[model samples]
Target: MVQHIRLVGIEASDKQALGYTELAHGIPHIEGEFGDVLRRSHAELIGLCAFIFRRQTPLTTEWLRQADNLLDRKLDELQRLPASHPLDQTGVILPGGNRSSYPLRWAELLGEILHPLLYRYRSELLQAPIEPYFGSYR
Candidate 1:
């Protein structure tokens, strides 16, 4: 995913890279092939955000707030899943036998990177131009 993002000349943060790596590794326990699908989907979103950030436009606080709200909803949904669900499983066995919630943690980390940019971009990101590189998951 970092390589994909770098193809567009954007250097992803260490947190973003680590989060995605953890997400990819953690997802298989829940849904096998689906993990790859999510990894690709998230990479697209991450690339898009990087592209938008690279544009350096001044964004409105309201837009940022809306973005954050959307991410919050996503986080809430992930957290609300039943413990037995594969999506909720982190595959990490702790010292006390507790499984880690790394998937949710990764999503939260992604939100951290995106939410702040809401107030930073002045114009809506024009995806058409960068669609070739950061468009739908391949």
Candidate 2:
């Protein structure tokens, strides 16, 4: 548990450092099964927008929770699993009574999820302070 938290922090720092480069190159465009790429890019843009607009509001942990929720939702869409499914090293998610300590890739999970959540809730998040102040309210 302790290591997991630290891993998340480390991954976040890396994301902040190489965010722009990642945005330019890491993501790709595709239709149908390529939705995940768009979702992540959207979330990344959300944080970038917030930074440009509100200098004071650090990206909220609420967004992180929402990203985690998004991962859960996506996994659910993939297939049915036990309440606590764990992804293997090769990204194979195993559910049920698999008593294995899941070695999750923090870089992929945290950095990716952060943006997807933000993109999904862009309206709810940006409408109040960002959009309204910028005169782009909807």
Candidate 3:
């Protein structure tokens, strides 16, 4: 079954969370998807905080900055791979839904790049739990 994640309440009201969801849904990996999503989430939180008479608190701003950096890195990595390399490899065959070596490598690198950022982001915000105000529901 497909599980749905939710973050509602005051936090859910943030636009960054929506952005995070969009980025996450774009990832090619089953696991790494959340990193982009979380980054988007943190960004939304920061924006919401800024709007609520808080003009980017140092804490929220820092999180947003980190999230943006992570996203930029992911995008850069995705762009670095040649379109054909991953989609078309020489003398290789795979089962349905399996990617070619080049693309798989690109995907792995993306995982490597995203894992740490995700852990750090989670570590920092997990406690805050923005149930509806800033955190994601999984």
Name the candidate that leads on TM-score. 2
Listed in order, each prediction's TM-score against the native is 0.25, 0.29, 0.26
Per-residue alpha-carbon lDDT of model 3 for 1-138, expressed as tens digits? 111234342353322221121123333343566656555544322212221212364444655676577657667544664445323424144455555433334334343443333334332221223223445521
Question: After superposition, which runs of candidate 3 have C-alpha atoms over 4 Å from their true positions?
Answer: 1-6, 9-81, 85-104, 125-138
What is each predicted model's overall lDDT from 0 to 1?
0.37, 0.38, 0.37
- Misplaced by over 4 Å in model 1 are 1-63, 70-91, 101-138
Poorest lDDT segment (10 consecutive residues) of candidate 3: 14-23
Best by lDDT: 2
1-138: candidate 2 lDDT, tens digit per residue: 001112222224312211111233333233355356564454334323233222223345555566677667567543543334433423453565445333344344554555544454443332112321335442
Angstrom error at residue 1, model 2: 38
Better model by TM-score: candidate 1 vs candidate 2: 2
Give stretches of model 2 more than 4 Å off. 1-22, 28-61, 66-102, 121-138
Poorest 10 consecutive residues by lDDT, candidate 1: 14-23
Q: What is the lDDT of residue 128 in candidate 1?
A: 21
lDDT by residue (56-111, candidate 1, tens digit) is 22343444566577657667655654344344434556555777554454344444
